[model samples]
Target: MTTTCLVVMGVSGSGKSTVARELADRLGWQMAEADEFHPEANIAKMRAGTPLTDDDREPWLRKLRDWITEHDEHGEDTVVACSALKRRYRDLLRESTARVRFVHLSGTGQVIGDRLAERSDHFMPPGLLGSQFDALEPLADDEDGTAVDVSGTPEQITDTALRALGLQEDAR
Candidate 1:
């Protein structure tokens, strides 16, 4: 059977980590946060309020793709929380061997910025929220993914994503 990788994606502060963790726990899949794949330099840049250029993201995206492929080789389904803001970035991720899909956690910039302002543990700053939204390209019709609104509670959003993605019944 082909392994599946659900990439919970969106601009930063869109609750990607919260929703991805819920999905992974409910589905009994291994989970990873995209921040974990970033090199120290990337993290530092974001922390310093500089948006990452595509060149800075290329190697990081490749690392994520490789991670998916490695787990797929082991027949393990996975979930990842990532700020896959651009269509090209998503396209690169789809190059993995796993049947990659996305769940876009989407909301207005105000909402996400509010959440980011309250977050204290992440490396990304609230000031960078604008840059994230500026770069985000919503899921295209041709993409194998669904977009979930972030207006609701985390559980509500996760439920919506599962239903939209046709994975509700598979939840544990």
Candidate 2:
């Protein structure tokens, strides 16, 4: 059977995790958090309010890609929260055997920054939000994905994603 992987992607504080979790629960699909794939050095850099270079993110992205491929091999549909800020990174992820599509959580800097300022549980510092936006390359028309505004509640965002990705009927 064919499987589909939904990659919930965006800059930091864009609500990727929240939306992805809701989508995964509603769709009853396997889920993974991209941050879990980060190396300790990457986590430490972010905790220090330092932005990671492409080199620092390569291994992390590869791990995520591998995760997708592994799930695909098992014919399990999946949802993952990843900050695939660059087209190149998304390209690597698209190599999966599963139909890997993206759901980009988009929001203005002011909005996301405000949300980030209120968070204290994550290793990523609010100060790095700017760097995430700077590195982001919005999905091109050719890419199999849709961009959803992150200004809404998590449920609302997930609803939009389900409809946009044609997965509404799969919602449980």
Name the top lDDT candidate: 1
TM-scores for candidates 1 onward, in order: 0.98, 0.98
| lDDT tens digits by residue: candidate 1, 1-172 | 7899999999888999999999999999999998999999999999899999999999999999999999999999999999899999999999999999999998988888889999999899998888888888999999999999999999999899899989999999
Worst 10 residues of 2 by lDDT: 11-20
Residue 152, model 1: Cα distance from true site in angstroms:
0.9
Q: Give the per-residue lDDT digits (tens) of candidate 2, residues 3-38.
A: 999999998888888888999999999999999999
How many backbone clashes are present in model 2? 0
Task: Please report how far candidate 1 places residue 65 from its true position, in Å.
Answer: 0.5
Top TM-score prediction, candidate number: 1
- Give candidate 1 misplaced runs (Cα > 4 Å): none
